[model samples]
Each structure stands twice: as C-alpha cells, then as structure tokens.
Target: MIFFYIFLLLFPHQICQAEVNSNMEGKLLNDLLKDYNKMSRPVKNLSSPLEVTINIGTFESFDLDEISQTISVLLYITVSWVDKFLTWNPEEYSGINQTRLPAGQIWIPDLQLQHTPIGSGMLSTESNAILDSSGLVKHTPPGTIKTICQEMDLYKFPYDTQTCTIEHLSFTHPSNELFLRLGDFTLDQNTFQSQEWQLLNVTSRIEINYYGGPYPFQKHIICLMVKRIPNYYISNMIYPYAVLASVAGLGFTLPPDSADKLSLGVSVLLSTTFYAGMVADIVPVTTSMPFLGLYCLVMMSLVAFSVVSTLAVINLHNRGEAKMSYLQKTIFLKFLPSLLFMEKKSKPSQVQRNTNHKGKVQVETLNDSSKEVEQEQAKDWKFAAKVLNEFCMIIFSAGFFIIFAYTIFFL
Candidate 1:
C-alpha cells in the first residue's frame, strides 16, 4: 500500500516536467519559424548591408604552371553572415542553445571570385549551417581555384618570387544592396605556409567603381607574395654543375702528351649536355635563359675550348723542326714563357779547349753545331707546351670563379 502511494506522487511530478520541456521546445521552434518563410523575399533588410566575413579553414595546396602562367590553390572557404529572421531567445526557450538548419531555409548572398578559372559558381555543400541564438550563420565550403599569376619572374628561377591574387565580389548584389568586408585577417596564417614556397604575406584591397552610373561595384582582391624554396635546385642542379666544372679543370693537370686529356674534356662536355637537358625539362622554354643555365653554357664552352687547346698541344709535341716555324718558336719559347711566369733551365754555352801546344784553337763543324741547336729548340718547344697547359688551367680556373661569383651575388 505504501509503494503504490509513492509511485503516484512521483508519476505526476515526472509528467509535469516532461510537459514543460515539450512546451519550451515547441514554443522556440514556433517563434523562430513564424517569419522564416524561406520563399518570401525580405525587402525590409535589402539595404541592411549583409556584412560578410571570409576565412580560410584549410589551405591544401598551391601549384604554379609555368607554361600557362597560372596558379591553382585548394582552400576551405568560410562565409559568415547574420540572418535577422533566424534569431531566438535562449533564456525564453529554456536554453535551447542553437540549431542546425538547411541552407535553403534562409537567404544567402551569391558570392564569387571575379576572374577565377575554376570554382566560380555557387558553393554547394550537403553540410548544414550553424545558427546561433544571436542569428549568426557560418558555413565553410572547400574549393579549388585557378587564377592568373603574371608576376612569376623566372630570371632567378628556382629562387624566384611570385605574387598571385584572388578577387571576389557579389555576383548579383551591387555595393548598395550588399557589401563584403575583410574579416579580422585574410588567411589562416598558421597553416598557409607551403612546402615548396615560403609565403611572404597576404594583403587585401577593396575598390569601388562606377561607370558614370548610379550603382557602384565593389571588388575585394587578396594578393599573396610567395618566394620559392630553392634547396631542391641547389642540391640537384647547382652543386652538381659546380662539381662537374671543377672536374673538367682536372684535365689541365694531366700530362699534355697523354691521350686521356682529350678524352676527359670530351667526356665532361657530354656529361654537361645531360645536365642541360635536365634543366631544360624544368625551366620554361623561352628566348631568355636563366643565370644558372647561362653558367652551364659557359662551363661547356670552356671545356670545349680546353679540348681544342689539348689538340694543339699534341700537334706541337709531334712537330718536326722543318714543319715548326721560327715565329712559333720565338713566341712560344720566349714571349709566352715570360707572360705565363714560367722558368726554363738555360743550357751552358759551348766552351772550346784552348790548351794547345803552340797557341791553337778548336772549332766544331757547322753540321755538328746545327744538330745541337735543333735538339735545344725541340726541348724548348716541349717546355712551352707544358707552360701552355698551365696557362690554360689558370685561365679556366679564373673563368669558373668569376662565373660562379657573378651568378651568386650579381644576378
């Protein structure tokens, strides 16, 4: 009998609490939907300046195409606004905090990028919008956009800087009807850094223009300045070329008479062609070559010149006295040696014995004297060839140094 009385008392209390909760939820929904006819046009707030705020949620990637001169960026674009008709008082509704409603249930501004090549239409999503008690609505849509990037300067290539922009405006609404202002910041600075590019900064600009008419058009442009990270090119393109250039110089140190000198120079020339092709694959095909490409070209020219000089040295080594000219002898043996700072051992002059029994002197025949002079001339020619090799080494070494220094600091 006592248990039956306790159950009846508790049943009424639970029923009353359920009834109050149900009424609060019903009243909140009824009030929120009273003026929320989605099909009805709200003329009262057409001039209320639908304050739009944009933010980035996730920046996936940014790719640049040199041939087309375009940049493509993948981003999660968030557009927020306040819907005056979607408000409800949380205190009056028993703290019925917020609601998730279909985007078709409310008015949304038609926003689009001005000159975007992709993702230019309405942002369609199966996701719902968050409607708070304060009437604020936030929706994030993921999209990819391809836009023009005419500021890619490849003269420095691999170390170049480029600025790309994204512009947006109301597709259907004019400045008087609707206005878009930048949010607190343009991009999500924490996650905008790219793997291959260092993002410098993002700046926003707004322009209002009227073509001698009553209505004005507003445009919002966001410019992104980015510099490429060149560590990949440095390791694969630059350092390898430097190593090859130094290796080509090693040919000069080899003996001029050896057959390997010409072979080494020719091998380096062929190897440079391979690297040049690799670089050509990466760089844009145009009339102007980058500084790194020029350095490669100059290095190849130097190696080819070294090969030609080696052939001349071999010819000089094999030349007979009859074939060798007097001018060649004077220039290579005297002038060139002095100019190149080379020292040659001087042969002792002929000393005739004058210890005769009765005041007599001894003289060698012309044929014997001519042979000795020819031998000394041959030795001088060989010495000059070696000096020529050393001179080329110095010239090529200096050329390499100048090319590298200029490309590094001047260009």
Candidate 2:
C-alpha cells in the first residue's frame, strides 16, 4: 500500500513535467513559425526611372546695363518613377503573381538642383537665369512612403547654357529691353509648349576694382564689378521745361527801342517762371541740378541782360540835349548811319526875310531840294527801324517754333 502511495506521487510529478515540456515545445514551434513568416514576407523594392527634360522658353529683359544683363527663362521639367515589390513565393500567392504596380508608384520628396555656366570667365554666360533654392520641388504625396504619380517643373529659369539653342535674341537701345531664346525640351515624347518669360527690370553700374599682388613678377589685377542702380523716366518731365526755357530765351533778341520791350520781357519771364514751377511739380528736389535746369538758368540770364540793354538804349535815345561823348557821337552818327543806310546831303543856303515891323532880319530857309532831302532822311530812319524790328521778331518766332516743335515731337 505504501509503495502504491509513492507511485501515485511520482506519477503526478511526471504528468506535471510532461505538461511543462509540451508547453515549452509549443512555444518554440510558434517562435520558429513567426521567424519563418518574417523571412518569407515580400520585400518592398523602390526605384526611380528618371526621364528628365528641359524646355527653355523665350527670354525677356526688362532692364539692362553695360556690365550685367537681367534675363528670365521658362523651365519645364517632368519627373516619373516606378514602385515594385519582390515576391518571395509567387507560386504560393496567386495575388502577388497577378498584381502589377502602376508606374510612378514611389515618391520623390523634392529635387534640389542648380545650374552653372561651363566657362572660364567670371561673367555668367547665362544672361537671365536665376534659380531660388528654397522649396524648389514639392511632391503631391503627403506622408512617408507616399506614392508618387508624376512631377513637373513649370516656371522661369535663370541661366545661360551653351547646349541650349538661343532663339529670338533681340535688344532695344535706350529702352534696354533684351530678348533671348533657350533650348526646347520634352518628356516621354510629349510635345512641349513654348513659354514666354519676362525678367526683372535692372539698372546696373560697373566699376573696375584693382589689386596689387606681392612678389616682383606679380602683375596688377583688375576686376569689373557691377551694382544695381535705381532709375526713373525723369527725362520726360525735363524735356518740356527745357523747351519752354529755350523759347523764352528767344525774347532776348527783340529790339531794345520799342515800348513793348518791358512788356515782352515781363511776359517771357512770367511764362518761364510758370514753366519752371511746372517742372518743379513733377521732379523731386535733389542736390544736383539736371541738364534742363542749367538751360533754364542760362535763359534767365539772357532775359535779364535784355532788360538792362533795353533800359540803356532808351536812356541814350531820350538824352537829346545832353552833350554826347566822342564815343557816343561816333556810335550814333558814323556807325548808326552806316548800319541804317542814312546818307549825308548838301547843306541849305541862308536867305533874308522881312518881319511885320518893317525890319529886315537874316533868316535861313531850306531850299525845296534840301527840304526834300531832309524828308527822305526822316523816312529812311523810320523805315530802317521798322525793318530791324520785323527782322528780330521773325528770328525770335522761328527759334521759339523750333524749340516747341522739337519738344513736342522728338524730345
């Protein structure tokens, strides 16, 4: 009976041990199955089949200078890709064998790229191409491992390349507009549409920078640098002022003897003043005066001289009883007569005349021939004055018209 009790205890312990062994074996088998499944799983394989194309469009220059040329270009880029998964056991999984992944299934987040001219010179061969590095490329798929369908780059690209064909290169002087052509490109045999690009308006100033190098054989180095300068169409505002000033200056040539001299001077001065005010309204007050300002100033000086000269001429003419200096006599008698075509005539004879009181007094009477000659002299002076006045007016009018016409049409 005691032996039977011992056997029961030993049997229970053996059963417990068997159960433990079975549990361990089952766990080990499960672990092995899990590892095998992991090893046999299909592996994701991603590849990018790159088809690159560049479509360079027409270049437009908004502004340009001697040293640097600002240009713009349209770049068309198309990117595509393929996503595939390697099947570990295609025979085991019919779905895996049948499934075909679409093209461009893999995503490329973004493309960061740059273009540099392939030349030795410091000046970039590309006149108008500039690229911004920040956020250059953006893919449609939002998440990690997102599927990529297709990518495209459509915008202006700044750069010049020898490999690219230039089309429609043209330049307009003074306007500073330049046009150039870059190469055309296509993706996957697709037709590329032409693009038009306009560059930024730029005004540049160039300067030479010189450097002296150390060593006896070293040569002086010179480098050209360009800086952008801001500009405006101030010429338009200045031209009108210049024209008005030139027209006003014509008033100076009018005859000094006329009563209209002061009137004309005042009228011209007021007119020019109005024009100057108009010019000031349009242009900013800067330290440096423009070319038009110089012209106006010169006109003002001439007008002032005309006023003084007119006063002097009137003073000389009115001083009739005043004894004239030799210089004055020479100018009035010799020079004036020659210039005005006043010819000298024979003197009248002296004659005797009787008064009402019966006393005879000797009186001088001009003979008929001498009287006729005196009248002719007076007529000649009047005619000469009229002719001189008309001549001056014609000249002034012609000059004023010319200046006005130029300002209106050509300036």
Candidate 3:
C-alpha cells in the first residue's frame, strides 16, 4: 500500500495529462482566428495613423567594401504595432496567455529598405508574430541586405569614420496609413559589437519625401556611424611604409662615391610608386588624396631628391682642383661644413725651433704644419663629398621626422 501511494505521488501529473483533451490549443487558435477575422481591415479603416515602432534585434554583420563604396549588413529587425482586433482576455481562454501564428495569417506592414545596392535583393526569413492578451503584435524578421552609401571623405583612410544609412519605407501604404517611428533604442546594445569596426552610434529619423510617385512616403532612416579599427591597417599598411621610408632615409647617409647610392634611391622611389598603385586599388578613386597617399608622394619625392643630391655630390667629388670654382670651394668646403657641424679632419703637429745665446734649443707648437695644411687643401673634393653626405643626412632626417609626426600624431 505504501509503494502504491509513493507511485501515485510521483506520477499524478502524467495520469492527469492523459485525461486532458489534446485539441484545446487548436480550439483556442480557432476561436482567436475567428474573432481576428471579424474586425474588418484591422485598423486600416480607422482615421488615426497606425504607429509602428521598430527596433534592431541583432546586428549580425557590417562590412565596408572600399572599392565599391558600399556597406553590407545582416540585421534582425523587430517591428511592433497594436492590433485591437487581435486581442483576447487570457481569463476566458483556458489559461492561454499568448500564441504564435504564421505571419501570412495576420496583416503585416509592408516595410522595406529603399536604398539597397544593385543586384542585392532584400532577404527576409520566414518568421512568426506573437499575439498577446492585450492585442500587442510583435514581429521580428531577419534580413541580410546590402546598402549603397558613399563615404567620400577618406582622408584619414584605414583610420576613417564612416556613416552608412539604412532607409526604410512602406511600399504600398502612404504616410497617412502607416506612420513609422524608432523605438526607445535603435540597436541592441548587447548584440552590437564588431571585430574590425567600433560601432560608435546609431541615429534614427523620419523624413517625408515624394519619390516622383503619386503619393508622398515616409522614410525611417537608421544611420550607423562606425570607425575602422586600425590594428590591421597599422600592421599591414602603415608599418611597411614606415620600414621603407627608413630605408630611403638611410640612403642619405651613404657615401656619395658609393656606386649603389643612386641605385638605392631609385629602388625606394619605385617601391613607393608600387605601393601607391596598391593603395589606389583599395581606396575609392576620388580626386581628393588621402593623408596616406600624400605621405607616399612626399616620401617618393624625398627619395628622388636623395638620388639627385647623390649625383651632384658625385660630380663635385670628380672635379679637379684646377677645375673647381671659387664658389664651390667656399660653399662646399667652408660654409657647408660649418652649417652641417662637421669636424675638420686632423692635421699634423707644427714644430718651431729657437736658438738662444748659450746654444739652447727650444721648440714651440704652431697650429699645424704648413705641409699638412697644403695637403688637406689639395683634397678639397673629398672634403666636399663628406660635407654633402652630412648635410643630406641632417635635412632628410628632419623632413622624414616632421612628415611622420604630423601625419601620425595630428591625424
């Protein structure tokens, strides 16, 4: 008897379920549908506009295609409206509070994105609507759509901020019939995160405009402002350029007599042009050049300057003492060396001897020996070449530093 009582205590709910009718849910659905169908046109016949509130459920993906200047996104959209006819008191319906029905069975707002990119159709998944006791109908539909919005100001490209808009409108219904508005918040905070982008903010507004059609329409535009995460760009784009710039700067320090000095400069210039082509392919083809592009041009110009300066130094080094002009000796040997803070080459010690009354010998040190001074003067071309190398190193170093600092720190 105790065993029987224990089994009954554990299995009472299962036994009761077997006795209940399986058709209760179906009966409730049938009753709800019958009442829902009786209300003619659900609020279309009413004088007041139907206020539809929309919220984004999930921001699945956001991508910017720089070449095409388009943004592709995958979004889960939620739209809610109050339908007076679709209501039923939960007390009257066997404790049934809410139910899910096929979306086709209910009247839905014909909302769609108007500025989608070409060849990219609006994709909507088969979804359902939730009908509550107080007649609140909520439908969340998932869509993967590409939008066409151009980001022209790419001056800070690879570190740029872009705003892409998703504009929605009712296709067949006019503004009087369907009024659209944003919900409390446009994006779901928990689901709105990106890997390559920082989702800055989302703004929403409604605009009434006529699209050359008979009736004017209302558009709900949701603008997403995002800044690109620069980690990838820094490593792949700017870092390599920095390394190449350093190599180009090193050319200024190489001896002018080196056979490879000019060759090195030419190689660096060609490399910059190649990188520019790559950047052109990635960024939008616009008349306004970006800072990165300007950086490339400036670097290439400096490299060309280095090459030309190398040639001039080589010519100066090859000129004989008899052929060297007075201006060349003054500028390249005296003024240029002083301007560049180059130390003069070492010279041999000068000796001066004096004989006194007791035949004592004394020696005094002059500045330098006359022979050594003359020899140093004879090698004016060598001194000039050294001056050129030092001068270029100082000037190009400053130029490279200023350009890099301004572009990186200010921008």
Against the reference, the lDDT scores of all candidates come to 0.74, 0.35, 0.75
- What is candidate 2's lDDT per residue for 356-382, written digit by digit as tens? 576767574655575665555554444
Q: Write the per-residue lDDT of candidate 3 for residues 1-411, one digit (tens) a residue.
A: 999999889999876664442355566678777746632446846777787888765686788887777787777678888887777777666567788877667777777777676643432437878878777888887556687875557888867888888888876777777888778664665675567887888777889988788767898888889898878766776767767777977886777668888888788888877887887777777778877788777777777777777787787666644345799878887898888777667655557789999999998877576666555555777778778877877777788888778767777
**Worst lDDT 10-window in candidate 3:** 116-125
lDDT of 2: 0.35
Model 1 off-target regions past 4 Å? 1-49, 56-76, 84-97, 102-107, 114-126, 133-135, 144-146, 186-193, 209-215, 286-288, 322-331, 346-361, 366-381, 406-411
TM-score against truth, every candidate: 0.76, 0.33, 0.77
Which residue pairs show collisions in model 3?
Answer: none
Error of 2 at 407 (Å): 7.0
Task: Return the clash pairs for model 1, or none.
Answer: none
Where is the poorest 10-residue window by lDDT in model 1?
39-48
Give the candidate number with the greatest lDDT. Answer: 3
Best candidate, TM-score:
3
For model 2, state the Cα shift of residue 157 in Å: 36
- Count clashes in each candidate, considering only residues at least 3 apart in sequence or on different chains: 0, 7, 0
Prediction 3 TM-score vs. true = 0.77
lDDT of 1 by residue, 161-254 (tens): 8888877776566777777776655456577646788777777777787756588878777787888888888788877887887888999888
Query: For residue 314, what is the lDDT in candidate 2?
Result: 49
